[model samples]
Target: MSNTPIIEAIKLSKQFTKDGDFVLNSLSLSIPKNKFTAIIGYSGTGKSVFLRQVLGLDRATSGIVRVLGKELHNMEPAELNAFRKNLGVVFQDSALFDDQTVLENVCFPLKEHKRSMSEDKRKAIGSEKLKLSGLNEEHFNKFPEALSGGMKRRVALARALVLEPKILIYDEPTTGLDPVLKQKVDELILTTHKRRSSSTLVVTHDLPSALHFADHIVMLNAGAVLFEGSVSEFLKSSDNLVATFREQGLNKYGKN
Candidate 1:
């Protein structure tokens, strides 16, 4: 993996209301290119908020966020739209359109951004991604409601891959999965990262999953980084917070 950062946040802060405490408090971090980086923390520690800053979905209260070397908050609408084409996001809820078929959901990005492309070409690409995500041909014509939780997650992943993004952002990818299914999803994510060689950032509460699959691990507390290093470093850290977090993770999920 490159030492260069694909996403950089310098003293970034965000507050939803004038009197509210900062959701992200002058947070500064960098995600290395072509690496699988997992951002882990307790709920409400601003993990998801940080994701919004990286995606340019919300403006920061102060500081800056740069993605692919461009200042995200300063980009023009058209420029931001163009830049977003390089990113693919898998939301926590899967966010599949219940009204659309699996194939249609996967092809949605192509329809919106590559409007000039022929329908047949879009379907071809969508079908390829769906298969890569472990879905069979029979699942293509079904709606989201007809699928299982794992199947829905796979479809969401397929849609994310359809755009062939340089950066892949996943929010709580294994939120509701059973242990076996969670492991499968984790393996699928690692396999996809290797196959695409994309820079991946996953915001998750699953410490065991992070420890098992991440090239780099970042821990957050009260919207600031508590620890940032390799999985071994995280595992061996002497910091109280890191130690406590590691212990809790081990107690809950067993050893890595």
Candidate 2:
């Protein structure tokens, strides 16, 4: 893996209006290539806001976001599109097309991005990704509505990987699932990341999952980064806020 960060945020800040408080306050962080990092915080502490900035879906009020060496906010539209092809995102909601079958949903990206790919080739790639995500051929023709929550998550994962992106992102991936389903999804995430060797970033409120799976942790509080370090460091933190917050997470949701 490269020493350089695959994604870097430098002095980044975002505020909806001139007088509004910043959602992300001067945040500077780096996500190293081929590593798994987790961002954890309270619901309204700007975790999702920071994630949107990372994807260039939202522009920062100040500072820069660099993804794969390109400045996201400054990129030309065409350049950004090309750059985006290297990243894949799995949203909180599976975001599957209810009208489409699992196979079609997985093949959607290929159809949009690789227009020259033949129909057979697209289906072949989709099948391969779905299998990699722990789904078998039996589920291919099933619509998203016919699947369980865990199955839907697997389909979303398959779709996200269809493009073979180097950077994989998950936004509240385990949200709304029961404890059993949540564990299944968490294991799937770890397995998929290890198998693909992609740099992964997860923004989650589930602290136990983050502590169990992340190589590094980024904690946000009151619109600023309160801590950034290894899981061990976080657990042993001297900051009362960090320590207390961690205890709460462990107590409420023990590691899988």
Candidate 3:
């Protein structure tokens, strides 16, 4: 992997109107190219908010976010839209359209951005991604309402991969999965990253799973970076917050 940062945040800050303080304080971080980095923190620590800023879906109240070497907040709408074609995001909710068929949903990004491609070509690409996500042809015509939770998550992942993005972002990907399914998702992520070689960011509070796969980790506490290092460093560090999190996570998830 290269040393260049695929995503860089400089003094980023955010504050809601009703909140008295910054939900995300002045924080600077970088996600290196072709690496799997996990962002972990307690609830309400602005992990999702930080993701929104990186995605250019929300503007930072006081700093710069650069993705793929372009300043996100400063880009024009058309430019931002063009730039975003290279980013694939899997939301915490699996955000698939209930009204669309699985095939259509998987092909949505390609249809939106690669308009010149024929419908058959788009479906062909979507089919490839769906198979890669471990879904068979029989699942193609089903709607989101008809699928199981794990199936829906796989479809969402297929949709993300349809674009062949340079960066893949997962927001709480394993939130509601059972232990067995969670392992499947973890293996899926690791294998997908290996195949695609994308710079991936997983925003999750699931530390054991994060430690299982991540090359690096960034820990947030009270909206500030509490720790940043390799997985081994994160596991062995004596920092109070790291120790506390490690203990709690191990207790909850078991030492793996």
Model 3, span 1-256: residue lDDT tens: 3677998888888987755789889888888888999999899888999999888999878988888888988889998998898889999889999899999999999988999999999999999999999999999999999988778889999999998999999999989998888888888888999998788999997888888889989998887788888999998899987898889987897674
Relative to the true structure, how large is the alpha-carbon lDDT of every model? 0.91, 0.90, 0.90
The digit string of per-residue lDDT tens for model 1 on 1-256 reads 3566998889989999999999899898888889999999888999998898888899999998899888988889888988898999999889999999999999999998999999999999999999999999999999999998888999999999988999999999998899888988899999999999888999988888888889999998999888989999998899998898888987887673
Query: What CA RMSD would you report for each candidate?
Result: 1.4, 1.6, 1.4
Q: In candidate 3, what residue range of length 10 has the lowest lDDT sum? A: 1-10
The per-residue C-alpha lDDT of model 1 at residue 10 equals 91
Q: What does the lDDT read for residue 79 in candidate 2?
A: 75
Q: How accurate is candidate 1 locally (lDDT)?
A: 0.91
What is the lDDT for 232 in model 2? 93
How do the residues 1-256 of candidate 2 rate in per-residue lDDT, one tens digit apiece? 4688998889999999999998889988888888899999877999889888878888999988888888888988877777787888899888999999999999998998999999999999999999988899999999999999889989999999999998999999998899898988999999989988889999998898898899989999977889999999998899988988888888777542
Distance from true location, Cα of 140 in model 2, Å:
1.5
Weakest ten-residue segment in model 1 by summed lDDT: 247-256
